[model samples]
Target: MCAVEDHPHGTEEWWDRLGAVLFGPWAPQAQPGSGHVHCEPDWSWTLVLSDYDLWCVLGGIGRARLNGQDFTVTSGCVLMLRPGDEIEVRHDPANPLTVGYQHYTHGAEHRSATVADTCPPHFLPPRHVRLDDLSEVRRHLDGLARLRRRPGPDTRARVTAALAVLLLEIHAQAARGTGALPPLMDRRIHDVVEWLARHPTLRLGLHDAAASADLSADQFSRLFRRETGQSLREYQVAVRIRRACELLAESRMTVRQVAAALGYSDHHLFTRQFKDRTGTPPGAWRRSV
Candidate 1:
């Protein structure tokens, strides 16, 4: 389940309060586990992590330094930092900030459960979403907490599904409210382009390219154009044409042979694509060059 707390980490008193809230009345938690204290040049802060928890910064404008990268957190942004990850939360002292966080942690049995090696690492893409009421999120967290408190054969499965749903919701919200393309888009698209360049003659599909980039087909298409200024189809055709030109210039292969080598089923179709791109058919273009 999700638990939320509104506490500032600007003072020692606040840190003590936060420690009590995160570690429970039974034990005093420390950094790299339930809570941490960081003193930066301009500000000081505290970070709290629940066991296998999902956290949401309900209200505040701050930056989270995770894995040496900064993520901006404002109202309505939810962050799920996996166990053992480091997060620092600093507030603007001039404004005397108020920050809210929703926490979720798994039970003892599920706490040791590792996401399948096959499961893809979760990525928090950049987005701009206005903060709305978070009652629904709170409810989900409550349900999650209840499920965690109970241990059974079905407990682990239920918790996993709940976490999946929470992650999907976060992704959907970020996608819907965004001013910038996620950094993941650029990295993923670059991988796709590189893969195509390395294997131009291999038969590739839209799905294949998307998978290589670790994105859904539609997401990859939109972000690919936004990042590279070219549609995936356009990019694929350009790669094929470039490869075909290299073959035409470097090899003594016939047009049909080149087309087949480039995964084109019809020689005429390949010629049409080449002519459209170069303003000349394959043979004429080769002769002219």
Candidate 2:
């Protein structure tokens, strides 16, 4: 069964003020393959990050049930699961399981569970990031573990800062959404995708998206979904919506300006699409959040 403990420090309130709090950084976590399964609602959250859990698998593999769906996770896979999500990891005897995890809260307030802590209302982090290369993650975790164990007047503060940096790094990678896997892309397409992410407002014709992959429109469409779990149009919309949310929540920009900044062509399209994803009109969503 997963362990539950009290907050490590005096007050979790500081997390809200600072946009992040990291606790329980456990690395090189392994479980004996005894075929034991833990089943419980077993969800946890604090007012700080609003109940989300971030965990990583560093080695081995195991069968897991997240909100009732069974799947497998292997080394270098990271998950930011919902606060109320029910999960169970079935210890596999053959390979065992090695895991690393930390609980954290992000965002200025509990308006949402978005990674940047910028989304209003509420949002969950991506399903997972399958890291073919784990060097960066390894460094962060190793440093966090080492820094946290030393005793000093500044030890806790230093650990907290390191944790914040680590969380941001993970979020940056998670920002890729369906396009997180760099190794899976052809060089030309990878460069194009990188450019697109940097300029979310850039409008591209269907042919342009296809040409980036050096494939026919149909082939590109199929491959994009297969690799990213979203269609071309849906992915583009996601990028724009994220930018819109950031501008609205963090800037003095008006709704119209936000829409324009995102290259929406018009507010009507932006409002409709924003509402479709966020379940509220842009103005209303901004106000409520």
Candidate 3:
């Protein structure tokens, strides 16, 4: 057996660090010039990026050359490029490209750190992943674009959370092709997660969730744990707690109101759960934030 310490930028320590930071309290700040761009018919440019760049093709056809590899960029196509990657981009004259792009940086931009370092962890999205259905991905991109135009009190937190989700979706899409699990099963697990996130307040039972995934309850339980490392019930609780945090931080809602909104009949239970997960009661958490 051999120990390989020199991991690449998107592997080993890089992935671990990215996962921690994105899931933790830190938010990646989009540089001043980050946003969507509509490329003209004759538009073409080449540049070496200095930080992380997320590029999504909202519409139209384009050609991109990244590190000497050419890509035909179409709608639903996503690309995550890192520092010093030379990229050349252009679009068709008849249909101009509407591109949603963001330039941001997480701390683990280099490959120097060893796997044992306690840097913030992040999930590294593939360099390219073409989604079969762009509806959901486009929704997030549109939300991001709109958020930029209408900044609000919770804009930073919302942006960070949304980007985290966007990356997860991209990683799931990439996983469809490369993961050891069957693609359909892997996709079903992610779909269930998305459905749960969308309906955070719903008190769905295990059977209902299994039905949504088109699997038996026992099967869904096993696979969900295998894929996500958490039981179905635990994930649901996490969803509620995450939403509770948002409500407490962003709105004038009292802790009781927040608990009620999340389908908690007894506010005390909510407080206990919040404390168990966050090391503080809801009120204290709200006050700290």
Candidate 4:
């Protein structure tokens, strides 16, 4: 239930603020300079750079010639250039392009390469992935901008960690090809989950509930984890433990009766699992409550 924060992308100052928060000294500069170049491409121009850079295409679609091959560049397309690599931007004569450039140096240089190489080749589909949706990327760019505005050690470490996670997520998404969820297999899993919630006294198992989903045991296990972020067994155990705590607090049921009520034939096993999860034995927990 966490809401996403919106940060506008316009002007060097806005980019600069983002850089300060995300990257240290690798944020893009608004003005063209020795390490920076701003060109309004008329038709096409080849770019030869000394340092590795990440280009964010703010407007217009074009193509680039990297190394010895050609690649298309469009809005939301991020082009990463290695040092000494040659690239060409072919823009429409009528509509030129305005690109945002940021060069990373030393540690940032290696970090940028490592991140790009880790991402899957088809992470973003041909025309669907928008660069603006990448908040972590924006964060890294912003962190770099901040470092340029004011340098510090703490900021650098923060930028490194953020960049690493961003790269990992991008790589994972690319490997996955698409970011869409599979269609639900009806509400069998939901029914099973609700059953566990309502009848905390029942000892649940894969076979016990597999028929409800009409799923094979293995399939059910995998789907449960994917949907609930926890294994089915884990979720069941959690529910039982919670009910145990409630019974211990509200009822005068002895530990043995509580264990039997929760479908645990062996009181000792129940006590062990309870202690392992709650850091105290059921008897101790009951007394404390």
Best TM-score goes to which candidate?
3
lDDT of 4 at 134: 45
Those runs of model 4 whose alpha carbons end farther than 4 Å from true positions after fitting are 1-45, 93-98, 105-133, 153-170, 178-289
- Give the per-residue lDDT digits (tens) of candidate 4, residues 184-229: 3337777888889998887777877786788899888888887788
1 or 3: which has the higher lDDT? 3
User: Model 2 over residues 103-222: C-alpha lDDT tens digits?
Assistant: 544443323444533332222335455554455776787786666557689865575567666654564455433333233454555665677789898877778888876889988777
Task: Give the TM-score of each candidate.
Answer: 0.37, 0.41, 0.52, 0.40
Superposed on all Cα atoms, model 3 deviates from the true structure by an RMSD in Å of 10.6
Q: Give the better candidate number (3 or 4) by lDDT.
A: 3
Tens digit of per-residue lDDT, candidate 3, span 173-275: 5655554213444788988898889999997789988998899999999999998889998989999999999999999999999999999999899999999
The per-prediction tally of clashing pairs is 5, 1, 11, 15
Q: Is candidate 1 or candidate 3 better by TM-score?
A: 3
By lDDT, is 2 or 3 better? Answer: 3
lDDT of 3: 0.74
TM-score of model 1 (CA atoms): 0.37
What range of 10 consecutive residues in model 3 has the weakest lDDT sum?
1-10
For candidate 2, give the lDDT of residue 264. Answer: 76
lDDT of 4 at 105: 33
